[model samples]
Target: MSGPLSSLRVLDFSTLLPGPYATMLLADMGAEVLRIEAPDRVDLTKVMPPFDGTFSTAFSYLTRGKETLSLNLKEDGAADRIKELVKDYDVVVEQFRPGVMDRLGIGYETLKAINPALIYCSITGYGQTGPYRDRAGHDINYLSIAGVSSHCGRADSGPPPMGIEIADVAGGSHHAVMGILAAVIQRQQTGEGQFVDISMTDAAFALNAMSGAACLAGGIEQKPETGLLNGGSFYDYYQTRDDRWLSVGSLEPQFSARLCDTLGLSEMKGLALSQKPADQNALKEAIAGKVREKDLAEWQSIFAEQDACVEPVLTISEAAEHPQLKARGMVIEVDRGDGELQRQLGCPIRFV
Candidate 1:
């Protein structure tokens, strides 16, 4: 309770990653968050593997700096308890289905009557309205429905399974935080609260960004391995002799020139800038062949001082120990309320 949002109080009715992550960010920035959980229900994060003591490491990390209250919203006076709490809490974040909160008698309008300045944010897969509003979905489904998976990954292999939950985190959690903060600002101006609806699929569609603009306005459909950044040029991951990968993003003329010279394929520098499929393929193949000649460590040593945007694709453990991330304080130790500290990922935002 010591950062920029120290004045704010949040009542979190979210269980899994999306809602919890949003609230976690707020908590990290010094918002006092109270997580309301049902006594009979079990959050999957609590039982997932890699436990520090009794609780999962992820649960400890996501719920960091937040207090928990076991309140069965189905009980006789549960809604009353929430209504009473809303008078003091500044915000409410929930991730249940569209009508579930209403059925429980703690929906936005019901609580807004008690506290007109309360910012109520709802996070869901498809949104409050739409054909798929009530449909259950995970990260992959949202990405696919939003057309994100269509233009990613190799065309022959289709979209590869993502290592991270992009739709859940980037779409649902991030959009929920943005919407809630925007509503909070609006409340400061108008002295009235509003319902912020966040749809993961909708956010994922918006994540299309440049590609979406090209497809909609320019009438150019983007395809896998065709875009400038999406593996169309030599700006892709190439495997090393040690089976490790190195990401090469030498797209600009100067960087590509340095990269080609470093790889001893200086003749292919012009091909690196080509938009034609044949030329790009030739350059990519040449770089890949040359890169495979050395192990990751050898290449790392060779390019250690180079400024060509060539770097190894480190594993999670490797990334944790990397000098840059270490310098930036991405990994941190959090108090576990028992005089012991648990190592966790730190919040990325740097409030100067």
Candidate 2:
């Protein structure tokens, strides 16, 4: 059967991660996406590492099941061509700084005039009218400004390094999809499309929900490595004897009891949620001592039949091939557009 969004048509003018990723979700649900680009100014991701005969692995994964067209916006009569094209496209997604699209004569207002029912979405760093709207920023910058990185990392160390772009994927792409779908729903009622302004900084800052509560409710700024979920409590990752890491998430009292009992540290059961630095450190050290006694594999195996949420921290390749993940069909192969197939993370949502 055709996917849920098979009837939708998307004109994607964004490049790189955020916009492409949002449109990729649409494509996965069977939306017809036309990735518009300038011939000279290609999407930066197209040149990213691990190429499949010049097609970037990252780009291939992002642009799966989509059509591409190169049109120089600055070319003569290009604006008219886009105007005519927008007449048929249901949704338009762009990632240019605030006024760039207006200058290119394809701004939301101009397109809205052409297609009054068009759902236009703009994903940017700071947003349309902010002082930093015109400023250039990326994932790390967004995370930093949004107070997300501030709460991340260890007590003495700075923000822990991230293996992936959280701000781009979670903040920008997710919010864009949500906004687009919401707008689509609203349009069904009003028959008039709306504009969605998605700021990576705004979306990332919203992620500060758990910590922001501490600040907003009582002006309590969450210091680095202090909150329960932010490396404060005994819930944390420990390095194993083999140098690999294991995530320790024995948060509930029962789980904590089970973990402590398994580690022969019954004394740590009471200190699982301790706020006292001394107590927390003592419990952490005790857990660390036990964790270091065994390799990650051994620790994982020991916890396999237990209630505690301890598991080995796998590398990207390891995670991709993990039996549990495979059992859920979270990983799947897609054509690389070159007869070769590549394994990439599949969509998590399921209709059934």
Scored by lDDT, the top model is: 1
Which stretches of candidate 2 lie above 4 Å from their native place?
none
For model 1, residues 239-278, the per-residue Cα lDDT tens digits are 9999999999988899999999999999988898788999
Q: Candidate 1: worst 10 consecutive residues by lDDT?
A: 335-344
* Candidate 1: stretches off by over 4 Å: none
Measured over all alpha carbons after superposition, the RMSD of each candidate to the real structure, in angstroms, is 0.9, 1.2
Check candidate 1 and list the clashing pairs.
none
Best by TM-score: 1
Query: Taking the tens digit of each residue's C-alpha lDDT, what string does model 2 give over 138-246?
Result: 8999999999898898768889768788899999999999999999999999999999999999999998986888799879888876888878877899988989998
